[model samples]
Target: MAVHVAAIDFGTTYSGYAFSVSAPETDLKDVEILSNQIWNSGTAEVASLKTPTCLLLSKDRKISAFGYEAEEQYADIVLDGDTEDYYFFHRFKMNLHNNKNITMTMVLEDVRGQPLPAIDVFSLSIKALKDHLKSTVEIKNIKLDDRKTKWVLTVPAIWTDTAKQFMRKSAEKAGIPRDRLTIALEPESASIYCQTFPSAGCRDIVEIESRYMVVDLGGGTIDVTVHEKIPNGTLKEVTKASGMVVAGLRLMMHLSNFSFAYLADHF
Candidate 1:
């Protein structure tokens, strides 16, 4: 039996973790899910529930920083003319989706176009988040026993089995035991999260036989899924998850290009 349930949302643009203590006596509705503290981008006044999916590695192929701090340090490194000795990566999650020939030894290109093993990049990034979560829980006087904790990792539903396996391998390399880790679909996770709110004001809307559609507008793609609540208090997918490649990041790029064109014409 698990004593804690922790979930890591490893998103394309941002990432974060949340957890709840497992108690058989407590009703599911009463379980409190606590998320990590807000992350601030050191370069600006920006803050969010999740940090940027960025990472920096030293010349020796060791992780140097992650999230917003990674961005800040990479910028400083460039300004100092030491960029050749460092690697900066951001928005690399989509590589898994776009590449159909993913392999255990495939390499990922950094911001500088330098290549590094994909496993190293992913495993290090996950390790950073996992370590932070453990520290956060420890601060609350909770000792996380590896045997009693179940870890959940969310990925896009459209991902191929090869990609999912890659993630699992990366998680294992990051120190999460294979038996204790579970992979969850992003749309499904979102649907369940929505059920936690009160029905009168957005919670408890998902009752037995209730059916709904979940559209996830993520940084990498837009995914749609239909789910029905079963008598077993679990959700069943009515249709296969379908998604388009165009989503948040694509929209932003289009808007940025349009803005640039307009400025160039005016100036």
Candidate 2:
């Protein structure tokens, strides 16, 4: 019997899944990336690589929308409405490192009193993603009944122990089994993929030493790692990496501030 392995890259801005299939030779090969594996569909065969990290709360105090639909609706509400019931926050992953000190509140007219915890909001999104994955993939027969499908989730290298623990807890609450879960540094995972390309080769003939700084500029954070390349083509970490949660999205928000002010004054 062939063994089936599933690898899930649960990113902040995007998430992806790749499966490993064992052949008759007992060798495993990674299959192509799966698409539309995370949400319901109403359109053509277009694939969704990344779902927005935003969630929409309905007047009934439930998760009314998610992913791109939530993103669109939230944008419309923020840009063109006077109603304050709807709550939306993009780049939610950046907020993970804020620890438990900061409390995010929502004062919806429908729901009385204080707002929901940031962690709860995050948990809801994580749960939605997990549910989506379970429905799309068939894993019952491949694995033993007692053993659940395993997943490898990627996180930033600079994530504190507390933050990582929080993420793991969130995953548990989202229905991901603790026994089957593994966490890999996001930059390391990206490096593994990048090293596969031939263009990343060095030029020296006899002895060559190369160092690369992998800068990951994502929607929520910017992480950079320095890797030392050895003769055998394997990279070793030399220096500690550094990252900032503030990124491109912050710049866009700054620009939007001015644009929104101008529009308000003119219109």
Best by lDDT: 1
Residue 236 lDDT (model 2): 86
> Where does candidate 2 stray beyond 4 Å?
1-17, 21-48, 59-61, 73-87, 98-114, 138-147, 196-210, 229-235, 251-267
lDDT digits (tens) for residues 1-267 of candidate 1:
436987898988899999888677777778888998788886798989999888889989888999999988876776667777888778788889889899999999775568999999999999889888898999998777755788999999989999999999999899898999999989988888787654564544467888888899988878898988899988889999999786667677456435533433343
TM-score for candidate 2, please give it. Answer: 0.68
Compare the candidates by TM-score and give the number of the best one.
Answer: 1
| Cα error, candidate 1, residue 98 (Å) | 0.2
Clashes within 3 Å, all models in order:
3, 1
Regions of candidate 1 where Cα sits further than 4 Å from its true position = 198-204, 247-267
C-alpha lDDT values of all predictions: 0.84, 0.59
Instruction: Please give the TM-score that candidate 1 achieves against the real structure.
Output: 0.88
What pairs collide in candidate 1? 197-203, 198-203, 199-203
Residue pairs in candidate 2 whose N, alpha carbon or C atoms collide under 3 angstroms: 106-115
Candidate 1 versus truth, CA RMSD in Å, comes to 4.6
